[model samples]
Target: MSEVTDLVEMLEKTGIPMSNELIEALLRTEPSDFTDFPLESFWHDFPVPFLVTDSGVTKTISAPHMIVTMLHHLELDEGLHVLLMGSKGGYLATLIDIICGHGGKVTIIEPHDEIAEHTSNVLERRKQCGLIRVLGKEALEDPAWDRDVDRVLFTGSIREIPDFVELLIEEGGFILGPFGGRIQQRLMKKEWQGGAWLETDLGGVVFGPMDIRESERGFPDPLFIADEFEDALILISSVLGENSEEVYRLERLVESLRELPPGLPEITSSFTEEEIIEHPVIELLMTEAEWLNELWPTFVDILGFDLEGIVPDLEEPLFGKRHADFTP
Candidate 1:
């Protein structure tokens, strides 16, 4: 059996809800280049896909559900031409193949020549070929990819949304990928409306790497503040419309405060837990804000020039320290 079929069988045995035989039937016939067992680093915790890298081989985790979620959100169907950049082990591409079937076309652009060759050979040997294609090229210079696709997917992160992506879409096509860095990403779709693009940010997510520009080294701080306050505000606004209950609470909070504060510390201190719980939108704001606050600190600690911000002994909260609060 091909490595792809073997993997599907393994996932099925692990209760991942997939059928190896069914998947094999759907796939195009291709030969297996991988005869020896793939090697995974000892540090890996999950079944990360692997590729034959020049520097011995590297493995990384991939979220199958995450891709499915993006596809469903885009309302993707057959007939859509998709461009996938940064092929990760061809596992994700296999899933997409099932979804797109033979009617839809998927072209994968990979920079790693060895990885490209392995994936290309496997697909060609499997008899489930033709509907899928592969190319070994740098994403930064691919002029043909500019605005020529119905949906563009970047498995890796991008420092900035490429102009080529805008050219690929046909005024209404959607593109999804990591916007900032590989550390964290928010799945976003841009719709061409009027004369400009309208952005819809889904939420914070963790993902595998992408075809990043050589100049792109670290995460680019987004224009909006990365603190708890901004997180809450953005989430509440996105969920409830202008006249919703959440919006009213935000307005009330703004009105009560004399001036805008710099960080979440000020906002949290200003209002009591009771006040926050009573507000319609403050609940969601609080949740997202707290999450962002927890995330930003870690990102900073890891990426900051001076490692002084690092929390050395970080541990999960001991929430139930005083289990029984009533006096005996």
Candidate 2:
């Protein structure tokens, strides 16, 4: 969103920039199959909890909007090598697998053994295990490779962006994740510009801790989290442009929407006319920009689909192929 020199050049390497193809890819691979949670939980546009560690910390797959947003900016293309810090239920990995094709490679570092195993089983079941390698943090000790990976992604929150991440990427590569304090973070982007990395604030998100043990930091301070967005609340402000009266008005609406309980209620499963208009998230999106109104409904339809019998196009990766992928 900046006109600065480094950020400008970094944007040129971006691929897919929208969520439609990602949604369609998701339909081909059932999200329910990747999680132990019930189907009801898997179908909503919210962070669905699938694993709880012995530490009593719960892990969740990011909401659909957040997933699409992260992958959208990740700039997936065929033949890329991506290093993922979190497994993301193998859901995100699988999506990456879809986009990267046979020439691509993914190395997922999942610190939790249970999650790592679960992700491996699902990928093997889907026959995608061949394209990805699931390992623990120990793998970082020896990141031996001839060239740098094209991208690095983190699905959870980190207190701050780690310095060592830059070593794992090439000149044009980038790292995308939530970087900030517990319970709230700015989704920051760090792009390697050959000389140095340039950063961009992708907006706010409240992903789970990078380590379940991070709960020791104490509960979220409302003072800090008051500005955070949960589930699809991030979407309301994601594409809003430069600081202006319109942006402020939308921010006010986001404040109101944030007051609602996290995750969509069961009513969203079966949308009636009254329910669509009355839904706070939908209202916020439709009111933010007239064109964006279509996006929310489109997501509703995609999330409501039956994934049982659909088949995805494995020969060709769909991400970054859309017209929107052409520009920064």
List TM-score per model, in order: 0.52, 0.58
The deviation in Å at residue 25 for candidate 1 is 10
In candidate 1, stretches whose alpha carbon ends up further than 4 angstroms from where it belongs are 1-47, 138-146, 215-328
Question: How does model 2 score by TM-score?
Answer: 0.58
Best by TM-score: 2
Query: Best by lDDT, which number?
Result: 2
Clash counts for the predictions, in order: 22, 1
What lDDT is reached at residue 63 by model 1? Answer: 42
TM-score of 1: 0.52
For model 2, where is the 10-residue window of minimal lDDT?
A: 302-311
Q: For candidate 1, lDDT tens digit of each residue in 1-328?
A: 3544554455455553334423443244221232233333211224344564777756443543454355455555656677787766565565566666667777788777888887787667554422778886555466545555777787766656676556667767777776765455677776666668788887777664464443232211112223222334444455455676545654554443424333323223355646544343333333444233333343333333221221122254311122121112
